[model samples]
Target: MTATATEPSRGLAARDDRVATRPLAARLLSRPEVGSLIAAIVIFLLFMAAAEPFRNVANVGTILYGASTIGIMAVPVALLMIGGEFDLSAGVAVTTSGLSASLLAWNFGLNVWVGILLALAVSVAIGAFNGWLLLKTGLPSFLVTLGTFFILQGVNLGVTRLLTGNVASADISDMDGFASAQNIFGSEVTLGPVTLKITVLYWVLLTVIAAYVLLRTRVGNWVFAVGGDAAAARAVGVPVRATKIGLFMAVGFCAWLSGMHLLFQFNTVQSGEGVGKEFIFIIAAVIGGCLLTGGYGSVVGASLGALIFGMTQLGINYAGWNPDWFRTFLGVMLLLATLVNMYVKRRADLR
Candidate 1:
């Protein structure tokens, strides 16, 4: 063969070889997310088999109701984690935001919409303060957020006790726009034999939007950059500080949403509400594919993680098992997921 002809033939063979190897490489590098998803499905099926009551439509609705709050909170928490920071106060923030809105509307007779705005504003302030503290002190996020968590926890309890003299929640039914808010947050619309709560449907919608924002947008790229290496990101003009601060605000805002829904749904609150939820939110994010070290995660994966929790919570009860085991189950799941995440991260780092 002529040299030129031989070169072209060799090039084609090399191209074919590259194509064949690409998919294999991708499969190997793929994290445990796919496996986790499959495991989630298996868990679901197991619940279905052993828990006959779980198969009922009403029970399904209950799970959805439970999952909604957790899933909603998980979205922004996952985003924040992917951006490389954690918000330890996010759990208590829920109570703060909820109480803010409820008290404003019920005590001062502020319009529901106005009260909501104020509550969100409070959340933003707290979130921004968290970011500012982290940036200024060069402290680890864990310590920063732990401080915020304690402060907020105190504020939630102290303020509520001083004002209401009871752990029961403030009611805003008399506030304007209360009906509309209820329709959005509290109303349930049925589909055939399946009853659906608006919160669950809202969760599904938010998950879709959050997933798109993370996986298919420039902001998503920024999230990874900021989380992976803030110094490098800032050096490259990626607005690392702004991104991290903004993510904290987003987490706060989500807490507000969850709190608002809770206020409307239950029409009551306890000072202790949401005190232990921060870890749960993080767990859901990690289980979904978020890395503790940041720069890697999927929103859909986080949502799935919430579903797993929701399933386990209800499924166990339906299965007639001791509810006390949930704590143990959560501990096991967290350990397993963390180990898997660490393994995947180590392999990627080596490459």
Candidate 2:
């Protein structure tokens, strides 16, 4: 009995950790989004107390609409950052996508769908190109994407001028397939008392897909591996190149979708638009639990981050505060969030 009891106890102690359940606190701390979630709740409560308009059910759609726009881009930006890369060009890339599609559809008199399809191809290719270049040259992604950002920015301006003789692309509202495209990308959906832009639905769907991929799929493992340590992952047979490149393409694809929303909604393209927007996307991802160091993040957290932004941005206005202080407020939130995330990460690591 003594021998048998000791053997079983030893076996239990040596149980494979892969199948072992972590303590609840450890598990909770391990989630990147928990800190952000708490922050979001705090902010929401503060706004609900300070601003009567914020408490109105009618404003729910407006808040979600704002969140969805940033959330859409935040999802992919979170993924790319997870893969240890940055796309500074992401902002201008959205403008490029809209401008390209609008210019082609109008100038050629082709169906709007044709330009959209072609733009998809171009956008994906641009992402692939960024990946390929990074792999070949071994330069930092920030540098590579920064160059692309400037190039695309200039092209957006120069080409729009060249084609339309104006700073913006011609309105494609009357083009063939315009209505259909608008219905798909720009329409609003009514949900009982709240009506929301289609992007809200898209944002939620994208987050679900990204979380599923990051958690359930082989691709997700590859992403974590590459981000954590590329050289080590490569030695272990991870497709680092493909994974990183694919991540860039994902960002490109999201940028395309966001651009389509802008295009279909407004029926016009502003060449100078979207500049400085990449930082917002990055900040959202960072707030969501993605570290600047790469390899650790949560898509759910990122979406929540976008929600925080939406609430803060609109809540200030609803509260009758000076909107000019928005930047300062954003800075405060970012700093607080970073500190909270860092403390959470350290606690998780200790556990």
Score every model by TM-score.
0.92, 0.94
Model 1 spans > 4 angstroms off: 1-21, 24-32, 343-351
Superposing all C-alpha atoms, what RMSD in Å does each candidate have to the true structure? 2.5, 2.3
**Which residue ranges in model 2 land beyond 4 Å of their true spot?**
1-22
On a 0 to 1 TM-score scale, where does candidate 2 land against the true structure? 0.94
| Candidate 1: 10-residue stretch with minimal lDDT | 27-36
User: Which prediction has the highest lDDT against the true structure?
Assistant: 2
Tens digit of lDDT per residue, candidate 1, span 118-189?
998999999999999999999989999999999999888888888898775676676698888878768898
Question: How many clashes (backbone N, Cα, C below 3 Å) per candidate?
Answer: 1, 1
- Candidate 2 lDDT at 161 equals 99
